[model samples]
Target: MPKLETRLTRTFNLQYPILSAPMAFAAGGRLAAAVSRKGGLGIIGGGYGDPAWLEEQFALAQGVPVGVGFITWSLRKSPSMLTDVLKHRPVAVMLSFGDPRPFVDEIRAAGARIICQCQNMGHIMDAADIGADVIVAQGSEAGGHGAVRGTMTLVPEAADYIRATAPDSILVAAGGIADGRGLAAALMLGAEGVLMGTRFWASSDSLVHDGHRAALLEADGDGTIRTQVADIARQIAWPIEFTARIRQNAFTRRWHGHEDALRKEAATVGPIYRKGFAEGDAEQTGVFFGEAAGLIHSIESVDTLIEQINQQALDCLAGPATRLTSDRP
Candidate 1:
């Protein structure tokens, strides 16, 4: 039982240096409250800015120090959505996948800390300039929409930049960190904590459908493909440069690189896709996950999972670096 104290845990008044990602549709009130109850920060996903869903989750959190997140660009479509969320006085607000400038001032004025997730140097610099309290270096290994940069390289780069520039801003690592080993490695890489999406997405408290969870359990890293296929097929208005990571099911295998084909046939395929999602057809719907899916074998409670990872990380940080260095002697 080693103490894993870092600026992040202290800054956020958390017992552990872990933060559950606000994954849209997957992370809800139960998941967020469960994580918060276990001493880790829980952020509810307000993905794509659904005011009703966001309000419902906030209420469900029931006075927990629960945070809320939004896809920055999508929130632009519904500007007042931020105000709606802000009135709740969330513990924190996370903005990702677009310019955070638009809402930075308001968030700061609201007296709540802001967490900005960035994929590249430019994005991070912008977050720093905006005075983000926590900067998450999200790699492409993360589920859902992401930018160019692997977690390994991006974490250190962001850490270095933060130290050099925004010394007060905390650095967090994201993408493919589903276990304790990854947590220890992130600490070594200069990050104060890790923002986990895929791991928490598979937790029992998560809102994942049984069918989608089945798909997630059956799949691994290779089982997912990063593409705008879902956006096109489901007719989501995502940015051209952005893409989502979803499990490779029959639907995706049928049209992996054929975006144009999916677009042309969206009229016919769209209904089926929507229906599959609605009916919980695992094969036809998108199951969002990251490369870390390969590392997750079972769905456990937030307390069990967070404690397991924390103790594992403590062991690694104290015992040896062998877990991170190599496999064979």
Candidate 2:
């Protein structure tokens, strides 16, 4: 990829205006550090506030310039874990799901940049009100949990919202952003950069199972599913308003709209789901991802993927396709 620069790179002090989303356990220290080393920001997913796992990954990072993210509600339960991690002084602290206001003071007191992943304009405003250093507009196409809004409309709306309310705050677009086209489109929508999950999940450094990665490579965008009760029934305890997006499989097909049934089957289905995770069964183990999965045909190194995406964006923007053809009488 050719050399490219954007506001996000300068504002966030990132080598590339690209970011690897905190994909729960999928994006562990190795993956996060790899992306950070490869000129992008890598945030270790402090998913559901697992202090032990967080500590283990932080150790694995070993002083790399990476940030850490947490699902806000879970962090509330384990307040001390956040305090402990902050002692290391991560580059940034990203908070998604639930209100991050209560913890913003502590995060800022540690001299860490604050990145709030917002699900809507209201959330964006709330993050700005809390004096967030940066706002990541996470549209519904994002993997794992999110609200109900497509990336195309949500990104631009969030951008416009921030531009009007907090012009100085940097905005990054998330959800279904995989290739150069996605990156360029985000910039057009008023984002300074892009935060990616599914694409990175398929990378060499990600903890995603090899078989699962292979399955994602074989699948297309249309294969993804967006559901709510699946995660709730599994006891993940995501906020009632947020939902998850994953690859559609037998499980989703059977329970997608059947929230009532999922609630009823939770007792029996939960055990099977856990078994699938241990056995690495793709049919049962959820393949968490976004629509961008269609653009990802192969699993490559983090460096290669990041470089290609940046280069592709530059090439497309410099090309003539962006110009309009007009004929006048």
Best by lDDT: 1
Colliding pairs, model 2: none
C-alpha root-mean-square deviation, each candidate:
2.3, 4.3
Q: On residues 1-329, what C-alpha lDDT tens digit does candidate 2 reach at each position?
A: 46567777887677888889988879899998999998899999988777788889988988898999988888888889889999878889999988998898899889899999999888888988887878999888787889887889988888888888888888999998888888888888989898999989999999888877887877888888878755846767667888888888877877778878788778888888877765656777577888888888888999889887877787677877743221111
lDDT over C-alpha atoms for residue 310 of model 2: 78
For every model shown, the clashing-pair count is 0, 0
TM-score of each: 0.96, 0.94
Model 2 alpha-carbon miss at residue 204, Å: 1.2
Stretches > 4 Å off in candidate 1: 321-329
What candidate 2 gets wrong by more than 4 Å, as runs, is: 322-329
Task: Give the Å error, residue 147, model 2.
Answer: 1.5
Q: lDDT per model, in order? A: 0.88, 0.84
Model 1: per-residue Cα lDDT over 1-329, one tens digit each: 55599999999888999999999888998899999998989999998877888888888898888888999988988989989888988889999989998998888888889999998999999999988999999999999888768999999999999999999999999999998889999999999999999999988899987777777778878888788888888888888777898888888888888888999998889898888887778888677888888887888889889888987788788776564432112
TM-score winner? 1
